[model samples]
Target: MEFSPIRILGIDPGLRTTGFGVIEAQGQSRVYVASGCIRSGEGSLPERLHVLLKGVREVCDHYRPQQAAIEQVFVNVNPQSTLLLGQARGAAISALVLAGLPVAEYTALQVKQAVVGNGHAAKEQVSHMVQRLLSLNGEPQADAADALACALAHASHATGGLATVGMKSRRGRWVSL
Candidate 1:
């Protein structure tokens, strides 16, 4: 039996708002499926993480994605905020892993470059490119758009190059380019 790579769930993790998007990868073509955000309003860090985990799990179960693509955590000027973001990311990862799903993480630069041909592209630029590439009519929120971009980047690389898709380090960890 042959399996089709049609469903993908992309996640942009944050302490406050975690964005999610589902996409379909058919052969060389990728299409938008759905996009939304998991908002964790003013709350404690642990509470926010709980919301992220639950929200991500619900999205995964609902979409039944073949694979999951998540954005890697980046540095922030505020150390506290950065730590909180990392926790949110960890929670998201845990949700996927617990659900027995394969995960690929992409850096902000890699996502921007894959979507807009520029590693340093602005959020709006990347969002616009995602909307254009996927032929989305209206504007998608920055986080949702970024999640879609992450899925497209994975699909593009998954079809073409191994390094682009993801590579396993000697330590047996998957790392995106």
Candidate 2:
């Protein structure tokens, strides 16, 4: 059977740096489109947020992705840091929404497990797996790799219902969410 390709955009949002990746997925195949980071330079909180929002909107406009997946904010030891990150995420989400794209949220654990087959996988592991899976020429930066992983996970879930296809032994049991 033939399958039409779906374009996906994934975002890893941070107060200082936001990462974004775009990919086209068809069946079990994934083709990378672009990946990069948006730096919110030294500025006031509102100004930084404006940077993030505009950056995300520009990416969406350029890529014209059909779907978007974003890494969910995890609570940090510093509540203030977490809150700031959440604001950044809100900015990113706002851009996606304004672009009329459906947004899906995935936790870091979920992204790591889907991409690297381990929930506790380190950033390097996630990067390595993302490069291997996407057949990237070189390892992407940490944040960009994470965004790619998030897109890959969404592809895995949206394409063939393969979220549980090869995960039985990885976690020693069938895992489906």
Candidate 3:
């Protein structure tokens, strides 16, 4: 079989700051390319969303990732906060779509489980694990680390049917939700 590297972009979307990470995978080996957070100044919702969209598009343009994955927005204590977060996610997805990238969605639980071996993993745990997994010089910021974890999860999902595909392993191992 021919071998080709799969480049993936992972996004953690937020109203004030949107984090993005890129990775290249070939076979079981994965390499981190770049990661950063796009911060939007104090502004209205529309303006913030616009900033997020532009940042995402710029990352897509620069990295040229073949695929993209984003963290799913979960409900917050405040309904308004949840709604705003969802809107930010929508803006991020729209930017990826406009760039013609196939986007995959994964929940925060999945990302945490994949990276830190627990659904209730803390942010610091994620940052530490992401640094080890990607062989980074140091732990990334929380947002960027979360984005990198999303990319790592997508790489794993593509290689094996852990969550998205729901396929069984040769040893008949299954991922418990």
Candidate 4:
């Protein structure tokens, strides 16, 4: 069997610092292309959202990814904070859609399980696993690592990597088989 390479962009949206990672998934291989953070420095809510929107658009233009994956926002104890994060996520998704890329969303638990074999994996564990999976020389920053994990999760789901590893998707979620 053969498969064409797919360039994927992943985003971890935040009000202050949004992280982005690019990867190429070909068959069973996942190659790291780039990763970085877009710091939406001190600013008003709208201003910060604008920065995130613009930054994500630029990343899409520069990387020319065919697909995108983003972390789904979880409800925080603070309603206001959750709302703000949702807005940031919306900005990122808007950029991806405007760029004509198919976007996928994954929960933090799903990403952790796909990348580190543990749904409850710690941030450090996720970072280490991402470094190993992508053959990165050093551990990426926390945000970038998370974005990479999201991309990896999508790649697994898209390329049947999960099934090869004794996992299966059921009802829009991955279940270990």
Candidate 5:
């Protein structure tokens, strides 16, 4: 049986700021419902991770999304920063899993290409396209908007079969959610 449209939450994870957006897919259309960021104050990595986890849990509870899409960490020149960011991402994912939600991961390039039609598009260009495609009323913050764009992109591409398929994993496989 064909399932009803699914709600999806997207996350752009960082140690200091983790952005999040929620979207719903219905037939051929996807709508951006909400977007925001989790701001972690200066603290130890573990403390920041705790904040990230709590923030993600709050988002999940508020949105009640069927699945989540998170941007994979890109290779940064700073190894230490990259590792910390990865930890933050892990915390976010853990929260989703604990909340009984599935998760899908996408690279930065994939997110940019899915939202802007170009993997190498500038941040402003991507943000602009996201606003236009999602039909947002006002400009969203760069990080939050990008997170929402990632969620929308996942919904569109997964529904369109441009990304991964099959949704059996507990972590949530990349499917049209």
Candidate 6:
């Protein structure tokens, strides 16, 4: 039996540029719908957060995705940077939840591994693979490519990509174990 396609929004959250990508998933096949970055500009902390939130909401409103995937924020050497990134990530996740969508979180390593078969793959490698996977005419922007990779990762998990990763789903969200 055939099933209707489900749309997913992928987010690569950042303070300055938050990337978003949308895709339609039908069975095992996935196609890109839209991908772009939200430029929060050089603004105050609250201002930046608001920009991120608003940008994500706009994407949600436009795409009407059933679910979402977000790249987990990693710690940086500078604690300040880490904290700011965490805020951005939270804003992005909140936007999706506010839209009544389930969210799935994946670490950079997991996203890279799922997309390029190497957890340590470079950004250029990821860009190449996403183009191949989606049969795009050219490579997407770096941030947009990362968002697309995150969406692809979530789709991979749905197809039983790896069992050891052990994703736990609850409260309309899927979190890595």
Candidate closest to the true structure, highest TM-score:
4
Q: How far is candidate 3 from the true structure (C-alpha RMSD, Å)?
A: 3.7
lDDT of 5 by residue, 113-155 (tens): 7777777889998888878888887778988988987797778
Give the winner by lDDT: 4 or 6: 4
Residue range with the least summed lDDT across 10 consecutive positions in model 6: 163-172
* Poorly placed runs, candidate 1 (over 4 Å): 1-3, 161-177
Ranking by TM-score: 4, 2, 3, 6, 5, 1
**Candidate 2 lDDT:** 0.90
**What tens-digit string does per-residue lDDT give for candidate 3 at 64-165?**
999999998988999999998899999999999999999998888888877777878889999999998889999888788888999988888886634556
Q: Give the Cα error of residue 150 in candidate 3, in Å.
A: 0.5
lDDT of each: 0.83, 0.90, 0.86, 0.91, 0.83, 0.88
How many clashes show up per model?
A: 0, 0, 0, 0, 0, 0
Worst 10 residues of 2 by lDDT: 168-177
Q: Against the true structure, candidate 4 has what lDDT? A: 0.91
Candidate 5, residue 153: CA error in Å? 1.8
What are the TM-scores, per candidate, against the unseen true structure? Answer: 0.87, 0.92, 0.91, 0.93, 0.88, 0.90
- How do the candidates rank by lDDT, highest first? 4, 2, 6, 3, 5, 1
RMSD, every candidate, angstroms: 3.9, 3.3, 3.7, 2.3, 4.7, 4.0
Per-residue CA lDDT of candidate 4, range 1-177, in tens? 788999999899999899999999998899999999988898798898899999999999999999999999988999999999999999999989999999988888888888888888999999999999999999999999999999999998889875457766564457788
User: What tens digits encode model 1's per-residue C-alpha lDDT throughout 75-143?
Assistant: 899998889889999999999998788999888777776778777889989888988888889879988
Tens digit of per-residue lDDT, candidate 6, span 1-177? 988888889999999999988988787798989999999998799998998998999999998999899999888999999998999999999989999999988888888888998888999999999999888999999999999999998888765664335766443234577
Error (Å) of candidate 3 at residue 158 is 0.8
Q: Which is the better candidate, 5 or 6, if ranked by lDDT?
A: 6
**TM value for model 5:** 0.88
